[model samples]
Target: MDFHYHSLPDLFEQLGLPAEMPAVEHFIERHHPLPAAMLLADASFWSPSQASFLREEVLGDADWAEVVDDLNSRLHH
Candidate 1:
């Protein structure tokens, strides 16, 4: 699959996150992937459910892997 956007905010929106630039930026800045990976699906934030969906439905399977990997790369970087 060909994923379009790569920025955290865009990926967030694609993944059904809030997608607000400022908020997304702040979130990425505050939560690094090292921790976000563990906290994403369980965090007390909007990502808990959303992240679970992405991890289980998207990345967990072969479908949407491109976007999921892209988002992961962007989030980690």
Candidate 2:
């Protein structure tokens, strides 16, 4: 089996968002500093489908989990 290493841009594409680095950076900048008590998947900016994808990937410890965790950290700071 081929293992594909995913990146933040890939995650954005998978979520049907802009995948360019600038767009990704802009997105993070727009949504920076998520509330400490808020879960990444529970943030108001995400669509239901996007939120579900994040929750499932993290809860299942799937391939997307690492990147999702990375996003979570970025959002928190």
Candidate 3:
């Protein structure tokens, strides 16, 4: 799917993580306000390649920047 528009679950699924609504909700509630880059770099569930692709490809690309920003906002207080 193009990263132009995505729901939180879609975004998480694309990132190779669990995208179940409750799981995502709990994760966010448990760890809201996560710094995008730091979380991506440090989260053990994500492989190095996955994190790099997300940080350098999705986040770095202008086309997907909006999606990344939205995720960041939801993550932060």
Candidate 4:
């Protein structure tokens, strides 16, 4: 079966991404759902460093701290 990323980034422009960076084609020859969601659902192409840059740019370090806390809280639950 063929599949493609169908995430918010692909649907909205407010995310500021190129609108075509993320796709299932990179992972599977025939296309498929992302192997994992959390790692692939959001803009799908973000690197760790790039994520940190975006966080710092959009949320600042203090806000990024809260974001981390929130993510940790959700993960632990």
Model 3, span 1-75: residue lDDT tens: 454666778767877878998977887787676665655435565678766756774446755556655665666
- Tens digit of per-residue lDDT, candidate 1, span 1-77: 54443555655776676788887767767755645455334444544567666667454554455556655555566
RMSD to true structure for each model, in Å = 4.2, 1.5, 3.6, 12.1
Residue 29 alpha-carbon offset, candidate 4, angstroms: 26
The best-first sequence of candidates by TM-score reads 2, 3, 1, 4
User: Backbone clashes per model, in order?
Assistant: 0, 0, 1, 0
- The prediction achieving the highest lDDT against the true structure is 2
> Model 2: which ten-residue window has the lowest total lDDT?
1-10
Candidate 3 regions with alpha-carbon error over 4 angstroms? 1-3, 35-46
**Native-to-model Cα distance after best TM-score fit, residue 30 in candidate 3, in Å:** 1.9
Cα lDDT tens digits, model 4, 1-77, are 33333343332232343444343222232223334334322334555665554455335434234434333233333
Candidate 4, after superposition: displacement of residue 45 in Å?
11
lDDT of each: 0.59, 0.94, 0.66, 0.38
Q: Report the alpha-carbon TM-score of model 3 versus the true structure.
A: 0.61
